[model samples]
Target: MTNRSRPRILLIGTGDTKADELLFMQRCIGEAGGVIVMMDISVLGDPPYKAAHDKHAVAAAADKTIEAVIASGDENSSMTLMALGASRLTRRLCDDGEIDGMITIGGTMGTDLALDVALGLPLGFPKLIVSTIAFSHLIPPERIAADLMMILWAGGLYGLNGTCKAVLSQACGAIVGASRSAIRPRPQRPIVALTSLGKSCLSYMVELKPQLEARGYEVVVFHTTGMGGRAMESIAAQGGFAAVLDLSLQEVANQLMGSVVNSGADRLMNAGRHGIPQIVAPGAIDMVDFPAWLPVPAELADRPFHAHNRLLASATSGPEDRRRIARAIAAKLAEATAPIAFVLPTGGIQQWDQEGEPLHDPEGLRAFVAEMRAAIRAPVELHVINDHINERGFVEKVLAIFDRWVADAVVPAGKVAVERI
Candidate 1:
């Protein structure tokens, strides 16, 4: 696109500190079929290699002079200023169609700056960071762009060694390869956004995806992990999807119960805000997530627990929590400017909520039902089906409501379908 044989890869780093490492990365990228562009984020010292844009240019980009930033001499504030500057500069390069991909290497301060810069770019753009804390839980999901890749800066810090060079060479090759093989956006289609937990909880997504595709609509299922729900809401808010099947309401219960897997404050409200035709359900509202690494919260640790795996454990929602979550969901639905079909599965919400399961909680389900029926208002069609969420009957009920929307012209009839990703 830039009329170049090799894609241009932007090398970003704090030149004052890791100049040698940054310079090494630059050379490695060049050897790996990538044209190198550099943006030096140094605050106190010179870069080992001359950057296309240096520390002075960076400070000026943030509307602050290099002299002023240096005068402050505060590591924290200076790093923040440099990151803002880098983000601004990176955005400009993207707008100008100059950068094809980007790679940044850093420890604490460097990693922090990389996050700001990488998040500034749009999705599908190749952004990679080689960081010391690549696998750490300290990273915030909200800040990191969905497609950003990170390599553990394994031995590639301080100075060059055989080990560090090996790691750097691998990172360089990865960024170049990624740039050469850039991802193209999915073709235009009527995107049906669906949310769910894994196959352990719901199988309706698997059943409905093909059925919807057969009817000529692309089904995009968003896993209802905390970040997954937020990402779905992000895309939906931007009008990326034509319709939304918000089948998993676990994030609502997670939010109400103060679980680690809560989406955010504005989870269920985005589709309503953007007037997207959405089918809502009380899927997986029976449980709340607790991190397996830590002990469950003292208040409800005694509740019915199901260890989903090593990393995640779930506890059954109580009647009070379910009622609160139902009210929250209802309130969000009430504000919908578009048609909403809210489906309730009477038999069970998830696999674990079935007969004789560890997560069985009829009292909590009853509370949710009582509150939902009372609180939800018009423009939202409520359907009560006497079957489990994974059952064929429940799947048909959802499809029927969506089909009705199509017939009523709420969802356009001549929609195109996309192959499942």
Candidate 2:
């Protein structure tokens, strides 16, 4: 096989039982003009061929010796050690620009090892797994990364055959294809991260994205879906964003109130802790989300409700819940050392929050505002705008804050231009 200047894909799996199949996949990748970096993670046996990262090095990376890893002699302990070791080593390889993508094929233990290492990589760094558990319903969100991909192992089990080879070849082609195409040459613009509930709530994001792009800022929008918020925060904590437009905070409410679509605990704190300037709003704070398949919790069914679709539903929060949400928002903002603007859209926060809508609870809104006023102090400037969040009036107010921050050099001015879309 000849090497091309294409992506070097990392193949990680057990060498004890699956070495033949792993080596077969390696040949397929090589024949496809891709480079392969093979890792042997088996505790009990050796690979058929030389491995780039072997069991000994894998164990050592985890602060354990291969002998100790083997001494444990259980599948759980062995897989755990190998996964920990592989994660550390793989991340370092990525940092040093050694591997462009990673893939693994295995059954149970192998799947766990592959996932742990691959998930440790950053977003857009193509990672794939051909596993028997790919179709399992018990996947925990924490085990999966934002962009990881998986396919059923199908006919591939103990050895390589026509059926398994076809599957393995497809996986090879996928990683190679991803390596060639997934990562873009990042634009030389400042990055701004924003959160919103799509069109389900009329959001400024539709207008703001292009405006920010026109100003030479690359805008990244994260839906306030539970995982969406967590993904945004994960990247933000890694210093990925120059500034944050955290306009939709319903995830905070969802989290506090036990909704299924809430970002995890560390949602709103990252950009602040990273010293990035932010414009914060309690957008869509009037509701909590639940999957459409599930009945509204008996406790929550009494609130005003909107069936957004068969997939999403929103339930209005009462005065007490609104007050609790406001306090939660305030507590999170209080942790920020960076400059922040807390803007409240006084007229309404969401589409269903306007006049004649199901969730238009002015009394609850007032209670929320009162709690916010009682909780937030200076250094976090507060502003109240009289228009609904979806209105141009609210958009302009947010842009005005952006412009002011640019003028004060709190954020990069970029090539300033804002055009209506």
Candidate 3:
């Protein structure tokens, strides 16, 4: 292990502990050659130290300089203490070696403090929490994304026995082993953005996955939820995407009609501003999604509502409403300098919008498409395909349009060389 890089470990212990207990843990860590960069004992209500003589040897603890940064004498002050400690540890990890893993042991407050520090790290970093409250369901799953291990102390910190020592030692060894192993890097692929609803657009994604991959593109699908739409737009603004296949434009209607998945006013504008090529489709544009009838609000209660599921209540868009949505979409589309194409699936936009379905309204659909075509000043091609939005034929048409646009935008090799020095 002398030639190999050691994984940096952060051990956080809370509450007053016997000196012997601290010495035992330190000896085990030192024997493993794991560099203990930061040890936070702020929960013990004791002053931070430089180095202390344990039973095995002298172990270096966190310096007392951190106390000045955590001068706020409140229970919530633990958060600040943990942040400072984690920052120091991460810095040390970045210095000579990579952070293979991080481990912390504490009570309820300590768990909260340690989890916050873990969340600040990137997605792939390893984190382990040994907590008295580890078994509790109160823990938020979002706080633990990467490879996180949680060990529940059955009888709390005071009940530590031989079993506890073995558990902690095993955890240390596991983290060290993980650090030495090589993680295969994913191939960098051009990102292709797609908007989808689990119900309506699942089939489209299944059919288009191979097609996009064949062209060396990584398709990133965004559920047309309220926050999901905003996330996709943010990525587009960051220039993280090669092209956008906006299959589900229902969130625009949701915004106007006060549905749950409303993407605000600036849904599709970011891609346009970034000058990214886009292929837009009116999937699920025929309806607006909401919760139950009780939460539908008094203003929209009189509208014709249908229960899509037990939780989802939707209303079919009328001709007037469709026209408004179309004009709004066209207005946003007109701002794009990049090549844009709007494909209209004439047969149906969603599962319920097909023939003999409850929400099928071709008159309203036609009016919407007509208004959109009239309003857009840009080259918004309207393809009246006979298949539904999720159909294989519809996916093929979208891929063709995307291929044509991509080809036209490519700079010739000879022209590229002439422009360069």
Report the lDDT tens digits of candidate 2 across residue range 325-394: 8988988998997999999887788888877988888898888888887888888989888888899998
Error of 3 at 223 (Å): 2.1
What order do you get sorting by TM-score, best first? Answer: 2, 1, 3
Candidate models: Cα lDDT each: 0.84, 0.84, 0.65
For each candidate in turn, the TM-score is 0.84, 0.85, 0.56
How well does model 3 score by local distance difference test? 0.65
lDDT of predicted model 2: 0.84
Off by over 4 Å in 3: 1-186, 199-202, 293-295, 302-304, 382-387, 409-421
lDDT ranking from best candidate downward? 1, 2, 3
lDDT tens per residue, model 1, 1-421: 5424598999998777887788888888998889999998888888767899899889998989888887766888898888999999998998799989999999878899999988788767789999988856577555566577888888765777788777788899999998888874574568888998998788898889988888887778889988888778767665677789999989878877877687677788878889898999999987889888888778777788898889998888788878888888888888888889899887889998876999887888788888888877787888988888999999999999888889988987635545598
Q: Give the higher-TM-score candidate: 1 or 2.
A: 2
Model 3 C-alpha lDDT per residue in residues 22-57, reported as the tens digit of each score: 445555655786655445445435523432221111
lDDT for model 1 comes to: 0.84
- Scored by TM-score, the top model is 2
